[model samples]
Target: MKLLIMSDSHGWADEVVQVVDRHKHEVDELIHCGDSELQVDSKELSGVKTVKGNCDFGADFPEEIKETYGSLTLYVTHGHHYNVKMTYVPLSYRAEEVGANLVCFGHSHVADCFMEQGVLFINPGSMRLPRKPKEQTYVICDITDTEVEVSFYERVSGEKLTDLSRTYSR
Candidate 1:
């Protein structure tokens, strides 16, 4: 399966729509780590699996989500209660509690894709405002039977060559 991962959109539907439309065929599922700021019941966002960010108000959203996909356990959250803008400790602890094989979060607007203690941690950055100088970015995740290949892409230029691998096999 192919999944498009994004976060911290902050109500920029035009940019988000453009990115999804451009990569629509290439993605099987879309996941947002939070800060969409759209109407909670908006069907326009139905394609994206979203969490609630600190800025996300008046909506019903779970603080955390865990599910099984392929051969991996995925844990998704927005990281406000976890204090993601400050550190990764809270999230790391949550992973341990959930025994997650893959962890997805957003809050700091910094692109992060890496592995630690046999778990994949992904923060897809903010599509509205990227924290770094490169560009606003997201990730394309290809999951197979026992492996996951995550490729990062810059939204402005639409490049998918950057590989951010947090794991290879179970």
Candidate 2:
């Protein structure tokens, strides 16, 4: 399965739509890790699974979601409640409790991906207000029985950032 993951758009609805349209056909699932700052019923978010961030006031988006695709289980959240800016401990515990194999979240606007204790954690960064690396980015994950490959891309240009790509053994 392939998944497109993005986060921290913070109201760049058009950019979000453009990115989704560009990759919709290649990914099996679309995910937004929150801070979108769009209403729950916004057309831009129509087919995407999203969570609520601290900035998404009264949007009625869920704080987290768990989904199973094929043999993989994903735990998605905005990460504010888990204090992800400080540490991954809380988020890791929650993912474990939910029996998730992959965890997706965003709060610090820093793109990152890594494996810890058998679970893969991904943060796609902020597409509108990036922090570290100074790149507006998102991620696409390709999953198979033996490995998971993650590739980050420039949000506006849709160009893959090969330097940020990673492949983890599953």
User: How many steric overlaps are in each model, in order?
Assistant: 0, 0
State the lDDT of candidate 2 residue by residue for 44-139, as single tens digits: 999999999999999999999999977899999999999999999999999999999999999999999999999999999899999976999999
Candidate 1 C-alpha lDDT tens digits along 1-170: 87888888898878888788887898887788888888767765767778888888886766677888656788999988888888888888999999898889989898877778888888888888888535788888777877778777888888764543344664
User: Which residue pairs of candidate 1 clash?
Assistant: none
RMSD of 2: 0.7
- TM-scores for every candidate against the unseen true structure: 0.89, 0.98
Query: Which candidate number has the best lDDT?
Result: 2
- In candidate 2, which residue pairs get closer than 3 Å at backbone N, Cα or C atoms, i.e. clash? none
